[model samples]
Target: MTAEDPTHPDLLQRWNATLLAARAGREGPDPAPYGHNLLARWAEPQRAYHTVDHLRAVLDRVDELVDQGGEGGELELVRLAAWFHDAVYRPDRSENEERSAALAEKALTEAGLTGHEVREVARLVRLTVTHDPAPGDLNGETLCDADLAILATDPDTYRGYAEAVRTEYAFVPDEAFREGRAAVLRQLLSLPRLFRTPYGAAAWEERARENLERELRELTGAS
Candidate 1:
């Protein structure tokens, strides 16, 4: 977890393996043509939001949720959703959900996945946008919460993530970036809890709120 610590090879391998297996296990069938096309593009480095490292971070966060006892029986769907959630990320578009879902549909279908399975993954991926789910829908809530877990990270780390996101949109003016980023931090502070899972909410909620408060104060020169 420390900055100096290297990326763990085992963890990376396991995630890649999981994605491949889950894709291969479906009932309907893999769109081999599209599959070949998508896989080639998936590994290429991108400047904006779809960075490989960001995808890895999301998977790590999702695993953290599972370790903390996220809802059972929906584990694969959550993990698959996490992988595909930002696969087709384009910073300028408001239709990230549909794009990501399209990528998911292509992959799931090629893997012989059925309509119901593809729909489940697509729904979970789309859930990242709404974020708010019924109290009982632990799976959806956990994945969505993990996506925002950066709010609960240490201030310096949170700041780094903020910069990364901004850099992804380097075309934006400095003033615009500052205003937009500050607003996002404020929204997180306004939330009841940044994390929806019981343990994440209980253990990290207070720190996340504090981090957001500090960011807001620094932005407005109030503290």
Candidate 2:
């Protein structure tokens, strides 16, 4: 979605609120410009799956996890991390997560967040690289779970997600894409659990595994 999209205003409002709450009455520049910058990044033309819609979905899932008692981390930081998680995405690059984390560190620092706050946000952004938070890392678990919640979507929605991901990597040959995508599905299926948060584990884990396995079968031509 672009700046002219209908949801832009509401997203900006959400960004402002989250940033201010994170600051906790500390002084800083107005949040609107920063929101616009991040929004533009999310709306970049090359993005298919990691667009503004994904940003909103992740943020909403973060709220759901917190409200459902699935997460006990610092909500504001998690929200910020969600915003920055795919901010620097490029389909062909493997270093997008690290670049996104660096962007969070620089932008949040310039926006007047404390050093610790900025670092935590960057760390959360980088955690998307694995989506496997270490034990007891509440904030990491929250962000990673929210980011991967798409895997648990209904079959039709999950198909759309898979298609969008394919669109992002359109340069890849069909066979290569299939092989790579199958490998990713296998890796996820091999994980002991797909969702770390209690609510996610209860509500999303089974469906996510089912979706991954089904996709893997399709990709690999398995019986």
TM-scores, all models, native as reference:
0.80, 0.97
lDDT of 2 by residue, 65-105 (tens): 98898647888999999999999999999999999999999
Candidate 1 C-alpha error for residue 168, in Å = 1.1
Model 1: lDDT equals 0.70
Residue-wise C-alpha lDDT for candidate 1, range 23-68, written one tens digit per residue:
5654443334443444334445444445655666777888887888
Ten contiguous residues with the weakest lDDT in model 2: 1-10
Which segments of model 1 are wrong by more than 4 Å? 1-16, 19-50
TM-score, candidate number 2: 0.97
Error of 2 at 82 (Å): 0.2
Error of model 1, residue 210, in angstroms: 2.1
Clashing pairs in 1: 28-112, 29-110, 29-112, 30-110, 30-111, 30-112, 31-110
Model 2 misplaced regions, further than 4 Å: 1-7
- Please tell me which predicted candidate would have the highest TM-score against the true structure: 2
Q: How accurate is candidate 2 locally (lDDT)?
A: 0.92
